[model samples]
Target: MSAKIEVIKNKILSENWFVLRNFTYDLTTKDGTTLRHRREVYDRGNGATILLYNREKNSIILTRQFRIATWVNGNENGMLIEACAGLLDNDSPEECIRKEAIEETGYAVGKVEKLYEMYMSPGGVTELIHFFAAEYDEGLRANAGGGVEDEDIDVIEIPFPQAWAMIKTGQIRDGKTVMLMQHALIEGWLSLT
Candidate 1:
């Protein structure tokens, strides 16, 4: 079944960081019923994320940062452990993630395997995140990465078992990180032995 949508109006509510617009539209469903609704949409463009792992070391790279949104929403300290991620801006998904890995984790990754693309929040945010995985080693460390500019990020390298257990302990609640870790587990990309 397909739903036909017609925009009645699009009013820009805010244009500070990204964009927030109010959309009034008429949706005609397959049942021939038409309904008018208003919704707010946040457009921050697309993004890319990568899970960097070291098979030989049996470890993975993750970043910890303060997310204001989570803080206001009941997160105690707002510090979140997440996969290396960044907005695409003017770069392709692969290019963005590769660059992000270096900038955020100090690893200039090679041979990235793109897992898939997903919409983290399709209801309000118009951002599609391209997911990827790559192998890393000490030889690839270009710098003591803590992010550039005003971004303060902590690059943490944890053993595969410990990192996987973080999920159960709620220490790693970031969706992208969880997904990548699960993917690695399901595909036997890392193991305890």
Candidate 2:
């Protein structure tokens, strides 16, 4: 089937960590029938969520920390297991990956391989987080990266094989983290063997 172009109307409902707004699309049939749709979205900045992986030593650097909001409804183990990620923060996905890598894990990435853009939760949020993986040595330790005083994070390094097992057994709960590691396995991106 084919689609046609149409004009739209958008109204802001509220703005916060993410933006929630109402939009109306006006579609006119070739025969002159009019149709409209009102939909709402949560504005999670078109930011990037990156995964900084070290292929050389076959390890993936991740951040583990307690999430307060998540605890209210999330698992009793409110500790979030996630990749090295953050908002785009005005930088390109490439730049965001590099910066977040150092800031969250203290690793200086040599290069980044683009994975894909992801909307963590499109049904409610607008986070178009991009995924990436870089090669580094887990044995090499730089500054211990974490967020500012307001932000809390603890960096953890996991062997590629262990990460793969987690995915295979459904132990990796984080969506983005699971996706990246699974891709690495399927694509042979982490086959040190």
Candidate 3:
């Protein structure tokens, strides 16, 4: 038998960039009881991220930008080093990651390998993040990518060893970025030498 839930109320709290809603529901339990619960959910839609690596140079492409949420949460300067990522926005996960890579890192990537999909913050946010990795070369750079007008992004290229070290030193704190880096290491796509 499947569990059943009925929504008692749904109120929109905000609808500026994305959406924030408060939901009240009654969930049927296995013990023949119904429990009522309330939760606030932030809906920003799903997103995709890519870690660009260059086997020839033994390096990876990353981006640094200011995140307002982190800043308000006591992250000193709020600058975050992360993999290139963006919302799906009517596009497939693979398509979104390709566009994000070019727009954020100036790399026109190809042949991306999909890693996994995860719910970033399931408790309060409704965002499913798709992770990917691709090989890149200098010849594939089409333009000087720094994101759109409102987005101030700085592209950085670092050796694989240095990037891995950053995670241990608390320099790279973004969860998605860390996961992709570790995936690369475990897959033997990176070398210590």
Candidate 4:
């Protein structure tokens, strides 16, 4: 299956936090039909997310933060519970996740196992997030992490069962958080009991 695609025009819409552009492309289908399509793409760059779990305590570290986009999209509180994540800016996915873990959760995680990569919103957003998981303990706490600068994050540790229940209760609506938790459960990283 091969489709010929040609970029017709590109216009920058915004470049504040990231690049947002409008692209017009001419595509020729396999049936010899040519179509012109216009799409707006938001290039916020790729990111990395980590789920920190403590096997002894049967708990996982998560973060809650305010999201303006979610709030505008009918989320009453606009606050979302999510895994520790950050954009991989000029660093490898592993390095970014490790730094983000300590910066957001205060856990100086050593070894992070890369799980997979996913496009959270492939239609309009050009972001591929690298997923990771690591074991953490209280002894590895380096500092009281709540993110840096203007990012206000609340670190929360919830029992495995409770965390899983949040998904069904609508409390844990973040996709990445849900994916990581389900991954942990399916992989037997979390104690079933």
Each model's lDDT comes to 0.95, 0.75, 0.93, 0.95
Q: Model 3 segments beyond 4 Å from truth? A: none
Lowest summed lDDT window (length 10), candidate 4: 184-193
Q: Of the candidates numbered 1 and 3, which has the greater lDDT value?
A: 1
For candidate 3, list the clashing residue pairs, or say none: none
Per-residue lDDT for 1-193 in model 4, tens only?
8789999999999999899999999999988999999999999999999999998899999999999999999989899999999999999999999999989999999788999999999999999999999999988999989999989999999999999989899999999999999899999889658
lDDT, residue 186, model 1: 83
- Which residue runs of candidate 4 sit more than 4 Å off their true CA positions? none
Candidates ranked, most accurate by TM-score first: 1, 4, 3, 2
Residue lDDT tens for model 1, 43-142: 9999999999988888999999999999999999999999999999999999999889999999999899999999999999999999999999999999
Model 1 / residue 102 / CA error / Å? 0.6
Model 1 misplacement above 4 A: none
**Model 3 Cα lDDT, one tens digit per residue, 1-193:** 8988999999999999999999999999999899999999999999999999887788899999999999999889999999999999999999998888888899998799998999989999999999999999988898888998799999999999999889899899999998988888889888656
Clashing pairs in 2: 19-43
Model 4, backbone clash pairs (residues 3+ apart or across chains), number: 0
